[model samples]
Target: MTALLNELHAHYNGAKLDPSSITRHLEDNLLSPESVLKIVVASDSGGEVVGLLAFTFLNSLVDPAPEKRLQCMIKELFVKESFRSAGTGRDLMNWVIAHAKTAGCARMDWHVKATNEAGIRFYRSFGAAPVADRASFRLMLR
Candidate 1:
């Protein structure tokens, strides 16, 4: 799990992943239910971890609808390069969709890098579209 996470983080940030930091963060968030949920997909042949999906459920303060207050946001999704075309990503996403629905989430949302054409295509395959009116901004604390 650490290795897979390292690969995913490095691919985007080009930073070395600290196993202890990752483990600690997961433990802290997971200990509090609904903070973050992580799911891993393993290869059937050798039980090697091939993909991972992490998402969080949040309640929008401004959304007045009771049943629609909760929204699921995918924090990260990644599949091993060798497993990209093997439906691993699809399976992980399908599971998250069902899980969110079952939990009464109003919607599921995520962002993909504009330069990641393959990621964009994969999300679009499931009817996901970019929100043209919105732009993503980030601030680095560290």
Candidate 2:
């Protein structure tokens, strides 16, 4: 959601997020039958979205288990600042975990910013451990 994008921009040293491009991307993915992207939103009683989680299923070459060829990658998880510590995040993560199990995912993965101590602590409470041997890199191509 736009709120999450704005928060991410602020957290990541002022990276810009173009709303139009994001809208186009989301629409394309949501309309494509083969797209693996999945999204979930938590809303208030009045139907205003307060949190959002976006994830996708991916094939892992290193995972050889037949039943677990697929893995779930959490692309983004965000809850409104006002809703933090109110169990909205826990509920969203629980849903995603259940969804992954139902989808036969071998594992679920996500990254937390090093500076995000609260986020790191939250994930750790779920018994999620960091893969110390691996590092993430990205090359943005315009």
Candidate 3:
């Protein structure tokens, strides 16, 4: 799992991930029934993990409708380079989307870097569109 995270970080040109932090997060989520985090992994016949998708279930008071109150945000979706185009990623995505719908989520959302043309293409093929009205922002606590 840590190796897969490292590959995801590489794809983002981001900082190295700390295995201990990852372990802590998994442990916390696993032990908490109220945890919103859900991570799904796909393994090969030989039991090697080839793809992963992580997402969070969210609720917003802004959506007055009960069915629209719940939403899902995909934090990451990655397939091993060797597994690309083998349907692993699509299978993972389909599984997550179905799971979200079953969980009463109104919609599923994710972000793709502007420079990641391939990523954009994959998402477009999956029927995702850009939200032109919103811009993403973040602040580092440290």
Query: lDDT per model, in order?
Result: 0.82, 0.83, 0.84
lDDT string for model 1 (1-142, tens) is 6667777878878886788887776667644565656554555478778898888889988997988899999988889877888898999999999998999999888888899998899999988899899889999999
Best by lDDT: 3
* Candidate 1: worst-modelled 10 consecutive residues by lDDT: 35-44
Write down the TM-score for model 1: 0.84
User: Model 3 segments beyond 4 Å from truth?
Assistant: 13-35
lDDT of 2 by residue, 63-122 (tens): 778797999999989887888899999999999999999989989999888788999999
Q: Is candidate 1 or 2 superior in lDDT?
A: 2
User: TM-score per candidate, in order?
Assistant: 0.84, 0.81, 0.83
Task: For each of the candidates, give the backbone clash count.
Answer: 0, 0, 0
Candidate 2 similarity to native, TM-score: 0.81
